[model samples]
Target: MTPPASLKLASHEGRAAEAAPGPEAALAIRGLTVSYGQTPAVFSADATFPARTMSAIVGPNGAGKSTLLKAALGVIPRVSGEVTAFGRPVAEARERIAYVPQRASVDWDFPATAGDVVLMGLYRRMGLLGRVTGAHRRTVRACLGRVGMADFEGRQIGELSGGQQQRVFLARALAQGADLYLLDEPFAGVDAATERAIIDVLKALRDEGRAVVAVHHDLSTVTRYFEHVLMLNVRPVAEGPVETAFTAEALDATYGGRLAATHMDSLILATA
Candidate 1:
C-alpha cells in the first residue's frame, strides 16, 4: 500500500519521511534478545522504525509485545543486543522519546490530578530545584486541550473513566515534546469515541513527522490505524507495511492454528 500523501511529501522533501530510513531510524533494535531467568522472551529481534509513520506491534498473548516496547525504552533489562534511538545510545536519547505504558500497568489511585500527571513529562526539561513556571503550565494546558481533556485538568486521575484516563496519559506524552512515542495498549478497554480520538491524535503526530510505535491488539483496526506493522510471536514474525505484514499467513504463524483459522475466514469475507 502507498503511504499517505503527507508522508509521501515529507519523503520528497527529505524531511521526516516515513520510508526514507530516517537518520538510521528514530529507533533501531539490532540482535535484541531478552530473557527472564532461564526462559527467553525475545530472540534475535531486529527492526528499524523510520520517522513520520505510525507503526503497530501486533501479536498474540505472551508474544513479548510489551516486553519489546519496554526494552526499547530501557524499562526492562535485556539479556543481549542493543537498542538505539536517533543513531545515539538509548540513554542519550531518553529525553527525545516518550513512553506511555499500558493503562492496566499503572496505579490510577496514585493521588495525582490530570495536570499533575501531565507535568511529570516536563521533569526531564526542568532540572532539580526548578519549579514549574507559567510557561510550563501553559504547555500542559495546550497539550491537554489537544487531547480533548482541557476541562479534566483538575480532576483526579482515579476519577476518570477508562478512556479519559488513557487520554490523560497521552496528553502527558505530548507534553514531553518527544520525537518518538512508545505506547503499549493505548486502545484497550476504551469507548469507541475514545479509540477514534486516540487514532486521530496519532495520525496528527505522524503528520508532524514524529514516530509513534504502539503495542496493539485488535486485528480489525490494525490496517486502518497504522501504516507499518510488526508481527511477533516471541520473535520477529513480520515487519513492514500493514498491508504486507498483516496477511492471513503471517497472522496464522503468529497466532497459532485456531485464531489464525478464524482470522483467515474473516479476511476472506472482507476481501470478497
Candidate 2:
C-alpha cells in the first residue's frame, strides 16, 4: 500500500526527500533533529504548515511534542535541521512570529501587570529607543479586548485566575500582530469557557490569513479545530489534512498501545 499523504510530506530518516516549502507555507521544518547531551529527542522531522490554517501537533507523553516548537524557535539547541517562517530563517523572521508557551512554564508572580506584558509584544514593532505612544496603548487595549481581558489589563498578572491568565498571554500575542503563531497547550487547565474564548481568537487569526500551530493534548478535539495534523512520536508519524492524515492507524503508530483510553476511533470517520 502507498504511504499516507501526511507521511509522504517528508522522510524522517531522509529516505524520501521532499522539496523546500514554497511561499504559501507559513512555517516549515525539514530534517529537524534535536539532542540533549547523548540523548536524542526529535529526529529528522519534517512538515510544512500552510497560511490561513490551524494545525495541531499531537503525541503521547515524552513524544517530543513540545520539543518541536522549542527546537524550531532555537530556544533549545538543535543537532541539525532547517526551520523557516514564511520562507525566512526563524532568527530572521522574529517579528512575523509569536509564541505562547505553556502557562505553567512561567512564574505568575513576576510583578508585571497584564498591560505591561502585552506592551512587550509591541517592542519589536516600536524598535529600540522608541517610546510607547498613546497609539501604542490603544493597540494594547484593543488586543486585550479581543481576548476578553480589557478589564484585567491594569491588574497584576499573577493575581488573575488560570483562564484569565491565558487570555492575557494571548492578548500579548495579538499585540504583536504576528503572521504565524506557535502555542503550547493553551487550553491546559483552562475552563471550557476560556478554552472557547481562546479557540475563537485562533480561528479569527486563521480567517485573517495567519497560521496558528498549537501543541494540543485533547485528541478528541483535533479534527474539531485543526485543518491539519502533525503526529509525533520522537519523530514524524504523519502530517497532512486532518481528514486523511489523522487516522486511527496513524494515531496508533504515534501513541503505540496507549490509544485505547481516548476512544479516538469515535473522532474519525473511518480507518485509514
Candidate 3:
C-alpha cells in the first residue's frame, strides 16, 4: 500500500530493549529535564546511544527534540540531568564529540571562506599561540574532500547555496576528529543529492566504529537511515533499535494525536 505524501512512517515492529551486555554506550542521559522560565521543555528524559551506531531522535514539533540535544551538550542549561559521553562526564569527553547545529541557526554572512570554517575545528589542537600550518591545511582539505566540497573550499560561505553551506559545516565537524557526532537536523533543508552526500559520510563514520546521533524530523527516513531511535514527546516515549522501536504505536504515542487516524491507518497498512 502506498501512503499519501502526508503519511510519513516506516514499518518496524517494537522490540524489547537488549538485555545482553554490549560495548560502552557513546552517550547516556539520565533524569534529563529542561525548562524555559515557567514551562518545561523536556522532562526527566533518559536515552542511550550505543557505539558504532546511527540513532535518530524523533518527535513532533515543540516536543523538545532540539532541546534535548542542547541540554545534553550543555549548550543550554538543564534543570536536572546526568549526561555522559563514552562513560565519562561530558566535560571530560568534550573533545571526543563533534556537533553540527541546524543550518538556519548559523551566521553565514560572517566573512569566512569554507576552508576557514573547517580550519576552526582544528583550533583546539593548535593551542593558543599556534598558527595554521601545512598539516592543518591538509587536514582541512581532507575533511572537505570527505564531504565532496573540496573544490568549494575557497568560496565564501555566504555566497554558496543552502546545500553547499550545509556540506561545509559538516566538513568542519569532520575536521574535529571526534568519535561521536551529534547533528541537529542535518537534513532539514537540502536537495536530494546533498542529503545523500551527508548521510553517506555519516554512515561511513558509523561503520568506522564511531557513533552518530541526529535530531531527525522526517519519519520516512528513520528506519532507512538509523539503526536505533529515541522517540520523544517532551519525555521519552520509547527507545531502542529501529527494527523494534520505530513502530506505529510509538509514533502515535510520540505525536500525541497530532497524526490523524487516516495517517495512522496508512502507516499500519503500508508497513503491513
Candidate 4:
C-alpha cells in the first residue's frame, strides 16, 4: 500500500538540529563515523529521520547499516560524529527511543520469559535498581496484548518460533513508550503473516506521528513498506522519500557498482 502523497520533510528540517535542514527530527546524525582499531566501518555520513515516516536504511552487505544504528544508540563506541534525538543529545533523549536489534543477535537460550523480556525495555525509565511495580507489569502485559502475544507472556522466549520471538520483541519496544523506533531488519526472517503484522504495527506507529528507521535488505519491499529511505554504503548514497531516493541511480551508487538487476536476482533466490 503506497502512502498518501501528502507526506513532507521540510517540517522535519525546520528545527535547530543541524544546518542540514530538518528541524525537530526524530533522529539526526551528522559526520557519524565508527571504527575498530584500524578498520573503518563507516565514514562521515549524515541523515535525519523525520517524525511520522518510516525510513529504510538500504544497502548491500557491509554497508555499515548495523553500525550506524549501534553507533547512534551508543551500543558501541563511535569514532566521531554526533547523534541527536528530537534535537537533543542522544543520551539526554534515551528514554524516548526504543531499539529492536536483529533477532539473530539475541541469546535465545537465556532463561527468560516473554514478559521478562518485555519488562526489560523499562530499565532506563525505572533506574538500574528500580523495582517493577504492579503498574509497570500491567503496562507490559498490555503491550504484549497489542502485539498479539498476551497469551504467551509466560512462555519461554527460547521456545517460541522466530516470528513469535520477533513479535515479543516488538511488544517490548512498545512498552518503552518511545517516540522513535529503531529496528534492525525486523522483517528479515519473518513469515508472510508476521511481516504483514509488523508492517501494520509500523504504519500504526507512523500514524501516531512516530518515526520508524529500520535497516532493510529487501529492495523489492523497500518501496512497499517504507515512506522514506536512507541508502548507505559505508557512506550515505541518498536520503529522501522512498520514491525519490530509491531510483536506479541512487541504488546503483549505494550498492557500489552492483547492479539493481543483480540484487533483484539475489533477493528472488534468497526468498525462494
Candidate 5:
C-alpha cells in the first residue's frame, strides 16, 4: 500500500531546508527535564549548543541521553523548562530542526525505497497538500549522492546491511536541510568504515555552520568525533569540550559505582 500523501509531502519539506543555512541559536536551553510516567529520565539539563559545532551526548545505557534529544524536539509527552532554537521556542521554530532516530528503533520491513524515505525529510516545507516535483526529486538524488547512496535509491530498505541502512537514514536527515540536527545513536552497531563515513558527514554539516548533536556510545570516539560534549546520567554530569568533560572524574560521576572509576583511573594513567 502507498504511504499517505501527507507523509510524503512533510518529508520533502524537511529535506528541502538542507540546501541552505538557518538562523543561529542565541540562548538555547535553560532548565529542561524529561520524564517517563512517574520516573524522570532527564533532570534539569541545561546547556547552550552553539552554532557550527559538532556536539555528542555521551553516557552509559539508561543515562537519558536519548531522552534529552527527544525532549528538545518535543517528541516525548512529559517535559518541563525551556528549549529554544535560533533564539525562539522549539515549538515555535520546529522547522529549523531535524532529527535522525536510532536505526534499531525503525521497522526495516516497512515498504519504502531509499528515495521515498529521503523525500520524507522535505515534508515540512512541501506541506500536506504539496506534491513531489522534479526539483524535490533532484534534491533527493543529490542527497543520496552526497552520502554515496545514489545507486541505492530504488533498493528496499530492508535489503540493505546495517551500515547501509544507517547511511540511508543519515542521507534522509541531510535531505531535511535543517540548521540544528539531533541524531540518536547514528553510529551504533555499524562497521568501522560506516562510522568514519558518518563522522565525515557530521563534520561537513558542522563546516556548513550547522549544529549537529548526536547521542553516541563509543567513548573512544567521543573526543575524535565531536567538538563539544554533553555527558549525562539522569542529570547533567558535564558539558564542554571532550578534553575537559570526558575526564576520569566526570566519567565516574556520569557512570556511577566502581566500574567507571576503575576504567577511568586506567585511562587517566595511560594518558599521563
Candidate 6:
C-alpha cells in the first residue's frame, strides 16, 4: 500500500531516519531509541509535530507511548537519537515546552490545594527564594478559571474527583505560557464533560498558533480531537495529517495484527 503523502515510514534498512519537518516544525525527534535494562521500549522513532497543529500519538499497550514523550523532553535518558524543539536542543528550548504527565503517575496525596499545584508552573519565574506576590496569585486564579476549576481552587487535590483533578493539572500547564504542549492521556479516566472541556482548550491553543501533542489511547476520538497523527509501536508506522495517515494499513503496522477485524472496521467507520 502506498503511504500517506506526509507520513514518515521507518527506514527499511533498520537505521535511524530523519523527518522532513520543514521550517514550521515545533517538535522533532529523529532515530530516538530507549531501553530499560536491555529491554527495548522504543526504536528508531521519528516524528515531527508542527506549530499551530494538534497531533495524537496512538498505539497499543506497552507501545512506549509515554516513554517517547519523556525521552523527547529529556526527562528520561535515551539510548540513542536526537530531539529538538523549535529547531533547537530541548534543553535550550525548555521553557517553550510544557509536559503534562499521565494523571495516574502523579501523587494526588500531596498536601497542596488545586491552586498550589498550578502555581508550580510559575516556579521558574518566581525563583527559589522569591515570594509569590499578589500578581502571581491572580495569575494562578486565572489559569484555574480557564480550565473551569476556578471554584475549586482551595480544595486539596486528593479530595477532588478524577475529572476535576485532570482539569486542575491542565490548568497548571496553561499557566506555563508554552508554545508546545505535550499531554499523556489527557482524556483518560475523565468524564465526558471534562473531555469536552479539555479538547476545547487544546483546540484553542492550536488556533492561537501553538502546538499540542498528546499520547492518546482513544482511537475513536483521534480524528475528532486532532489534526495530525503519529501511529507508533516501538517505531513510527505513520505520521502526518489525520485524514491521510490514520488508515487501517498504518494501524495494522503499528499494532502488529493485535486489533481484531471487527473492531478495526468499527473504528474506521466511526472516524470516517
What lDDT does candidate 3 reach at residue 14?
Answer: 17
Instruction: Put down candidate 1 lDDT per residue, 93-198, tens digits, no spaces.
Output: 9988999999999899999999999999899888787999999999999999998999999999999999999999999999999999999999999999999889
The count of residue-pair clashes in candidate 1 stands at: 0
lDDT of each: 0.84, 0.86, 0.86, 0.84, 0.79, 0.86
Model 2: CA > 4 A from native: 1-23, 270-272
Candidate 4, 141: how far from true, in Å? 1.4
TM-scores, one per candidate: 0.89, 0.90, 0.90, 0.87, 0.86, 0.91
Candidate 6 lDDT, tens digit per residue, 52-83? Answer: 78989999998999999999998899999888
RMSD values, in order shown? 5.4, 4.7, 7.5, 6.2, 9.8, 5.1
Model 5 TM-score relative to the real fold: 0.86
Off by over 4 Å in 3: 1-23, 265-272
Q: Which pairs clash (backbone N, Cα, C closer than 3 Å) in model 6?
A: none
TM-score of 6: 0.91
lDDT of 3 at 218: 85
lDDT over C-alpha atoms for residue 70 of model 5: 84
Residue 16's lDDT within candidate 2 is 19
Superposition error at 37 for model 3 (Å): 0.9
Note the residue pairs that clash in candidate 3. Answer: 14-244, 15-244
Q: Tens-digit lDDT track for model 2 on 1-272? A: 32343354334224312343222667888889998778778988887877778999999988888999999998888999889887689999999999999999999999899999999889897999998899999999999999998998899998999999999989999999999999989999999999999999999998887899999999888989898889999889988889888987898899886878458667675323
